[model samples]
Target chain A: MDFNPIWLTLKLACITTLLLLVIGLPVAWWLSKGRSFFKIIIEAIVTMPLVLPPSVLGFYLLLAFSPQHGAGKWLQQTFNIQFVFSFQGLVLASVIYSMPFMLGPIKSALQQLPVSLSQASYSLGKSRWQTFIRVLLPNIKPSLLTAAVLTFAHTLGEFGVVLMIGGNIPNVTRVASIAVYDAVEQMDYHAANVYSFILFAITFVLVTGVFIFNKYQLKSPLE
Target chain B: MISINIEKKIKTYQGQRILKVSGEFKSESITKIHGPSGAGKSTFLKVIAGFIQPEQGNITVNNNAWLDTVSKISLSPQKRMAGFVFQDYALFPNMTVKEHLEYATADNEWIKHLLEIGKLETLTTHKPQYLSGGQQQRLAILRALATKPQVLLMDEPFSALDPENKLALITELKLIFQELKTTVFIVSHNPQELDGIAADGAILSELYINN
Candidate 1:
């Protein structure tokens, strides 16, 4: 069985998860703790990917990534980077697509925490950054793990966005989901089953691992 | 000395009311504050600690203005460096008892001293969930003092302690405060717990009674 798509999918998931963690931590913290008029608007925008059709997001992303258009044109002239039909484009699309999966649980976990924990850290002369990294992040380990697992799994299962933006470029953007679609269209049930089974096993293991870890985390101490 | 003159509008279920307070807390002394619930006692400590912003206020500690609304100069809480023991004993759940003190200060000797003072040396490896209410309360107090802060603000610090533990802890705290020359502000529902530790005839009540 060809495993190029498998490795590509894993690579995309890993990259997307890493980037989302860096991006999601602050966004989730702000959504949960900040007092701003734009809070709801930003939250709505982050969650837009959840309810939005992937094709729609991909179409708009494709337009934005076009080297002839506004963002695309600016990018091409400025840094000579093409986003559409590239690994970078898939990364960007996956980040947007899996944002809610990463941000929602983290925000909820932070919001559930007592306000006093951060305040206590601050009173001990810890800065906001210190409190976030040392105190807040440590307390929300389960949420972080959940966010990572969900984003990785969700990114693995992505089809429409990858289809629209990635366009099934083998070894570059032909992730397992796209590979499976390709296999089916070519009357290759055996290859399709292999891809499907792998994707399914990966997602199932991740989600179940999250559940078990959550159980253990709960039994230990995470309140 | 911590001198505070502040006015804040507190919105409660009853209605909106102004919390106007002004006072000079002496340096290296303990001030006991007991008042009816919803009297902004907690809020006052928060204001002094720079956690809450008062509308019109000036907080000067040792002649340094921590907050001056007129000049729009407000220090962040990290800069304030006030050790606080919250009423709920907001210990980080993920951290062991030792880690809590470690997080506050890198001084191993200081942490050891704090743990001994709180009688938590044996439980240092235990997390908050494994601790009893009194143990948790002591941990909170110990964590606060771990920073060796010049100013210590405590809200109902002994609410969960037994009378015996309370007395012992209070005795230890008095010595700790004296040793550190810390200015202490304590909000307590049980005034008896602070009898000798608090300044004589200085137990202020209803300082911010909203009604």
Candidate 2:
């Protein structure tokens, strides 16, 4: 019911959105150009998260980051970071859980671009990396923006993964979705409605924004 | 300035048809490729420009081997140093004339001069979709020239333009090439586009040479 949960959700969305954009750009580019067998395998893995149950993802993440587990123990010993039951842990989990949302549109955009573009840049004597940075990235701006927006909104509304891995620890793991879940469990109708309305409004606006931008982009040739 | 000795094949679903062509393009010349569409005229242009690959061929430019099937060498496109003007324009449809001009380069006083000379100065902000057919073709010309390539490959570059604009562009391009001292290869089904532009000297029937 409180506004604090809403604020927390926004913060999480903003952070995840930025992280996905920073990481997803080059990743999507590689996926676009790669011919390796591992490419499809990795794509399948990324999209698996999209189709997988949120709770199952949370379970695996928790296993990977628990101090008693092999990966978690190694990370804790080397970097002194525990991914389970922490806000940072939640962010990592969310990023992993949402990888497909960012990668798909980006891959599609890169695919739609003609190979002649990079070739054209090359014919001008620019190197491969230069052509990618200068020519290719500029062309895929709309897709990049779309990836960011979808990832942000998707992360904001994430629930099962946050609850399972984050353990609903207030201030540290108590995301707004979890708060709404907690309100419903206690049968507090007013409080539940408040959190629910905020989440609904945020997602509604985000989707509407995507459509608006998409329409404008279609009218323009840039997208 | 550029030379290509290559044998390529266009592999359709049925079978591959070999395209064997070799030639040199010296600076200060306009080379015209004249052939029927199925003769792989455009395909050869793409091979020299590094957009297409030959099954078993060698492509060398300015004493460099870009592709040597016998030697198992395939260089990336960026290293090829070519300028290509597609029959389709291939302009970044979203970009403006200014951006396209900038795409060609900003340092050359000659580029700036060409902008004014071609009368493209006023259309710098216009996108290709908004441009007239002739204007879009000029945009392609502007882009190719900016690359400062040793050789330029054009695929029917003027096929869509009106006579006046096409003639004006050819004039501007010729002047720019003269000043830059560069080599160009233009693809034109029209004898008129090839007639005046291929001023260097005849190398073969329907082909010309500069040196």
Candidate 3:
């Protein structure tokens, strides 16, 4: 019956999706350009989360941000910020776990756009940045929406990474997925069902919205 | 004057081919570039517009070095400021006919003039998808001219227009080009497409590229 986990999950998903959108756009744009070995390697690394087990990523993150050694130690000492078992840790993990969802659609859409669009913009004395913001991004609005919704839904469903890095702190790190696990462990089936159904309903709505919006966009004259 | 001597390697269905073009185009003149399919006619326009970088080349526009591979001084496409009307139109699906011209220039009078010249003033609020093929083609040309560029590169610009429309548009364009003093490089498969414009005493130099 406690709603703290649901609120925390929503907060985490919102923050993670926002951060990834800001970071993913430029990265996706860079990766969409013509291929090179260096770009291929970077793309592979960004795409690793989709295929790699969430627990594996969580385990590495745990080690790296343990505050006892390595990056965690430096971060804690220099910035007085702790990433392990904290809300910040959950946000960071969700961003990493759901990156492919945010980037895949965007990168493919950008690549699919006719190259002449940018060239036409450039010939008008528009700078590369201007062309990207004014021309390229406007044409890919549907893809952008799809990417954001998918990332949010994926982050909402994240259980393994959240459990591994963000232990079960009440309001700080206990998102809905982890809360469901905790409820089941304590033999509270009713609480577990409530959390499970809510997560399922939200994700279903988000994914269905994306499909409906995309279909309408296809019929609309203005892309 | 614009002098270009460039060699670019391009990929065709047959395989790799080198496109070498050397020409000196007079200012305020119209040059018709005719070539066979896959002969790099479009590629040559892109190179001049600075969208494609040739392996070795030098392009000097009015005695200013736009490109010099030896000195590694190649201006970016923004610096070139050459207006281009893509073969496919390349109109922004999100923009209306008026918005396309407005994006290229801030002068309202110039935009109004371009719309009238293209005969697209009545369809200014329509997007590319709403416009017919010929209308879209005219919009592309109008958008390019909105910038009032010193040079304009057009590829198969009149392929969609009917004979009457083509003739009317060409007649208006001839006067506009002279008024603006814009050097034009038009690529067309049909040799007689712009004959009327060429016959009107504009310097109608011809360049051919064969594979």
Q: What are the TM values for chain B, all candidates?
A: 0.94, 0.86, 0.98
Q: After superposing candidate 1 on the true structure, give the runs of residues whose Cα lies further than 4 Å from its correct spot.
A: A220-223, B198-210
lDDT of each: 0.89, 0.78, 0.93
Better structure of 2 and 3 per TM-score = 3
Interface RMSD of each: 2.4, 3.2, 1.9
lDDT of 2 by residue, B1-211 (tens): 5666777767645576777877666656777777665677777888877778787778766678888889988776676667788777777755787777676576767567767766788887888778887777777877887867677788888887777777777776777777766667777787566565645543322452111
After superposition, the stretches of candidate 3 with alpha carbons farther than 4 Å from their true spots are A220-223
Q: Kindly list the per-residue Cα lDDT of model 3 for residues A101-192, writing each as its tens digit.
A: 99999999999999999999998999889999999999999999999999999999999998899999998999999999999999999999
Q: Assess the local accuracy of residue B118 in candidate 2 as a C-alpha lDDT between 0 and 100.
A: 60
lDDT of 1 by residue, A72-98 (tens): 889889999888889999999999999
TM-score of each: 0.94, 0.90, 0.98
| Poorest 10 consecutive residues by lDDT, candidate 2 chain A | A214-223
Q: Between which residue pairs do clashes occur in model 3?
A: none
User: In model 3, what is chain B's TM-score?
Assistant: 0.98
Q: Tell me how far the alpha carbon of residue A109 in candidate 3 is from the true structure, in angstroms, after superposition.
A: 0.7
lDDT of 1 by residue, B105-141 (tens): 8999989888888999999899999999999999999
Could you give candidate 2's per-residue lDDT for residues A48-163 as a string of tens digits? 98889999999989888898979999998999998889888889988998889999999999988987777666777777787777678777887888888889888988998988
